[model samples]
Target chain A: MFNTRSMSKLLVVASKDQLDGIVRELYRHHVFHIEDFVETEEEGYEGVKIGMPLPQASAVSTELLRIRAIVSAFGVARSDVVPERKESVSALSARIDAELPQIEAEVSDLVDRRNHLESAIRECETKIAELEPFVPVQVDLSLLRGYEQFSVLAGHIPAKVELPVPAEMYFSGDVSGNLLIAIVPNERLNEAEQFLFEAGFQSMPVPGEEGLAKDRIAWYTQEISRLRAEMEEVDEQVNARKEKHQTFLVACDELLTAEAERAEAPLRFATTDTTFVAEGWVPSENVEALTAALRSVTNGTAYIAEQDFDPVNDNVPIEFDNPDFSKPTEMLMDVYSRPQYTELDPTLLIAIVFPIFFGFILGDVGYGLVLLAMSLGLRRIITGGAGEKLLKVLRNASVSSIIFGVLYSEFLGFALPWEPIGINRHLNIGAEAHGHGPDIVLMLVVSAWAGILHITLGRLIHMRNARRMYKPGKHRNKVVFGQAGWILVMWGILFALWSMFELPLMPSFTGLSPIVAGMNIVTLLGAVMLIVGIVAIGQENSLELLELPTVMSHTLSYARLAAVGISSVAIAMVVNYIAIGMMIEPAMQDLSLMGVIFIIAGIIVFLLGHTLNTALGLLGGGLHSIRLHYVEFFTKFYLGRGKKYDPFGMIRKFTED
Target chain B: MAVETMSVEVAEASARGLVAIGAGLAVGMAGLATAIAQYGIGTAAVGATAENKDIFGLVLVLTVIPETIVIFGLVVALLLLF
Candidate 1:
């Protein structure tokens, strides 16, 4: 349960003619993780090079590209269609051969028409904007342009100015600026331009259309509407095509993708003039089945053998073999990294502990129900992927929250009828009538104890990992001793604190007589353990001795479990106090139209306040809980960077054999 | 004699207020320190995440590692207040 699945090195040798059969069998079995071959110039490796892909690879790729283009043109998304049943490969191939070209031609033609209409619509809109500035002038568009002897200047000017030469000018005034048009003789154009430049004139080119500006604008608007109608028609045609062929396109895409992968599989193999060799990793239990499948496919011409390899030296891909209950936690594990084949898998431990931490932080019945409903609702909508996996994790966390909520007797910061069966988080901030206020102290101590236990578990796991990684020797013994020293140090700190302070739930050793000076027997024992632990750790690596304070600090870090929970509870109470005590109660004292409005506003406030708090609770509880594992807990032992096992196969959803 | 008794009462009240202020400062200053530490780390983490999205988890853990200081300060404040 703690280890990844065992893998065996698989080597398959076959004649060149049987390469196709071997590839087919391997892909169907879906157990091989092929390691690509690299050419070498040493020894008997002459003429042994990486094999070329099958001759049909190029054709398959071309067909795959064409299908993809059609699929994209139709705007078909995978989620847009649900496959009713798996399609037969032969039938799909025949359909592709018969109908793909017609579909492609129709889609391309419609797409071209759509593109043409869109660009034309954009041109008309641009023309309309250009003509809009001239509408106030009320001049002919032909008169604004096509002036040879007279230079026409038209644009917005700050104010009217006298031209240096005699010219015909039109002026219009508005809030933005004055629009002006001047027709000056070409002989004196430079003098007129210089005079306009001084008046802060921003010039625009006269549009190249004929007739009145308003008339041309009206024509362009009508043209735009007509083009838009045409565009809509093209879009409707495309949508119809999408509705008709979306399913077939999605299936064809899947089938062609698989075919392309199969055709290109030989590129990973090592081949000579007569034979090819494929090397890969397979799960040990499936080795026999795979060998049998290969034998049947090649008619005894292929040779399959299990090659011995060292787990330490070889690059064995790691596949998690966790039980179904703990499988979803692999998402969390993957966020960090996959565990090495030889390393201990911590998925089961995380699965058990992570949700507990989440529940402890957000222990409230109302919020728990909200989260549960949200995760379950989202899970139904998002079927598969990281999002679905995350929702599954949240489902587990919400269930844990419900359990903790029951124990805490908290329902959205309101006290339940029955007394709290667990730590009374509400009591920390003056919920004394409900319970004793010093429960906060108890909560802190419990969190510290949790930290101690969690860190000790990490140390033990590290020791186990050390034993597996190293042979019994001075170095291995030192590493194991170092981990043990950390455990001892944690216990020593706990014992010392217990002896010094009369903490809740802890037996006080303060009553005992002093063994040395003011130190009691328990205190002396704790001191001795601390010294010995430090010595052992220093012996392993003296630099680690500097990190002695971290043991105390890391233990204190777990106090956030109580601290964060208390803060959430405090916020929830404040929200209730404001919405009910400050607003609704005042409104209730007097009944008027304003009072009714105030009451409604108060209800809105309550709902919004609770919604914000719930979101905050999820963020705080989830991030903090997972952070504890990733930062504080995993830092103790986890050294992950294992290769993921990706077998050579496709799990077809839309197509079948 | 009456004035002396009143002065003693005033002294006790002020002492209590100081302790409260001390607790607040413990948490506040630590939070500020944590913010300062996270500033540099957060910017670099964002840059790294932009380049490669897969390291988001690792960067998140790194970004929050300094938050332990704030938690430590909170523990101290809790010790002082209750």
Candidate 2:
């Protein structure tokens, strides 16, 4: 809760293997790296630089060390000029680490190869089934006597043609009735060709155009099946090799585990800056031994503080803590939520007013209850920071709707179905029963009153800030005769109007006569003091022209409450007219197609219109709420230009995990 | 004062027509503003990347800042359409 402007620096000394351990410790404690050795400080400007920004250092350095260590340990002999000597024991360790992974990898590769061959075996089996139908049946052409006699009459013409069987195969053909015929096996085909020639047919040689794809499928299938069987045998051999490889890998993994553990162990450091700083936190009983240990480490250069055991408790829940920001844009994001460090957080104010304004704009119980239920459901599913912020906003908005629903005396767009406990119901909107619906004029008047209070609160916040930063006496005077003064005058003027107009009340306008008069005097004094402050500010800024118009215009801006209230009700009336008109017709019929459709459409449109109106109202309310904060409230008490705090560790690239 | 009264009437009509044209040009003027703003930001982003390839992410975020104006104008156009 207390702010400290001081910064601390510490230096750590640890074994070379424990470098990562020290870095991790620093990271955990939010201690940012001030400097580091990194290659290529600027893009396209490759060089080994002594230091880089902490954000970049954290991202790039860890991998650089690991890669360098791995390369050195493997004894690749980086260069002769490299200072490190490759000893026998270290070289042996490196070989075991490298070869062992290779062995395991090779085994996995063999297993994958076998699996692929197995898939091929299935494919071959399918091809074999298809080829079975196409296998040729045995036949004899010379057996028939008639066929033999006809062959004598037919002269054999040497008709040459390329065969699909292979280029080496020959074919002879004789034509019967201009038909040319050839067979793939020329020896068996000659007798048939001779018979065809004698039947008075002419023939010519032609290239074979028939498809043999089925035959090829059978051939390839058989070949693949045979190769697959061979691969199965190979797989058995590979598995045996892999078993031996696995045993070797196990030994290497153990050695690597030992190395990793050694690398991970915390280093014993005697450095005064990092080591001795812990002495302050040591219990009183252990003070002597800790000091003795520290003396042995730093040679007594360490300056240590001893204090009584009064533990500072930082037990605040994380949700309540101000969000950690490491970049400039985060400051703007904070403004969107609330300036938590400031006395007044705008988000907290927005949570109160935004929903109320939306409810007034909507003015329907059914829609409000539905929205409230939806908001509550949606809040649980939200995950992102911005999404969560939006949910928080909606959660408050829904609550406002419920509150306004009560005021409207309508539930689920109908009169509350249950009996009233204390307050009497005025009208049942669902039944279309009119019993003097909420007085629009009265709503506007109340809206203005609320506006006055909100504006006053904004101005009060600003005044408080000014008081906190500068002279309290002058600020306190302004708060009374300046901020409070305007609020009083507004109330007084409203009361006087009520009195003059003889507005409705049980006691009547004349009841508070003395109070009204006294308020008028106070209002006058406040008006004077405010004018003086304005003139003084104008003089300071050298913009006296801005003083009068700005003051007058800003004060009158509160009247927008009345304007907006009237507009909201007018919109609702339009919707109501639309909805009710849907239920009626020229014939005044009880049941009609047009009437039903109209009713359905009107109900839908009415809900949509009210919801949209409510959304717009919420936005306006939120912005005006902020406007009041920025111009009136924050101006009073906040010094907004203060630099925000940023403690650094990880620089997460939002694109990455 | 005019020798030709019809000519004077034509001139008045022309002036009114010109005003209507000016109104139509308003959208184009906003578009021009958006274009100029986008170009300035886009070129700066390109130059930044040229200096440092690693700054692509930062450059992309920065480039989108000026695009907001174009988006706002687009919204206005959509509102007009609807």
How many pairs collide in each candidate, listed in order?
0, 14
lDDT for model 1 comes to: 0.87
lDDT tens per residue, model 1, A1-657: 799999999999998999888898898888899998989998998999999888889999999999899988888988768899999999999999999999999998999999999999999999998877788866668877777898999988988887778999888785257788999999999999998998899998898988888899999999999999999999999999999999899999999898888889988999999999999999999999999989988888888899999786677899989898888888898888887778799999999999999999899888999999999999778887667888988999999998998998888887778788857766443323434553678889888877888989988999999999788899989989998888888788767877888988777887888878888888888888888889889889999999998898877889999888877888887778778877888899998999899899999989999999999999989988998899889988888888889999877779988
- Candidate 1 local lDDT, residue A258: 84
DockQ of each: 0.64, 0.04
C-alpha lDDT of residue B68 in model 2:
34
Give me the iRMSD of candidate 1, please.
1.4
True contacts kept of 1: 0.58
Report, to 2 decimal places, the DockQ of model 1.
0.64
The CA lDDT of each predicted structure is: 0.87, 0.44
- lDDT tens per residue, model 2, A1-657: 111122222333333333443334333333232222233457653432222122434333443344334333322222212223222435546665576456545555665677778777777766555433322311222221133222221122344433333222222232222223334234445655545445444543221112353555557767886877779686667756644443333333333333333233222222222231121122234345544554445555544344433121211111122222212222222443323232333434544455565555444455556666766677667554556566556555556656665665555344565543322223323445565544534443454456556666766665554454344575455444454444444454544455445543212354344444454443444455555555445433445334444333344444343334334444555556555544433224666777677667777877877777566555544444334434433444343332233322332211111
What ranges in model 1 sit over 4 Å off? A42-44, A175-178, A197-200, A427-435, B1-16
Candidate No. with top DockQ: 1
Docking class of 2: incorrect
Off by over 4 Å in 2: A1-23, A31-347, A353-363, A411-438, A471-545, A548-552, A555-637, A641-646, A650-657, B1-82
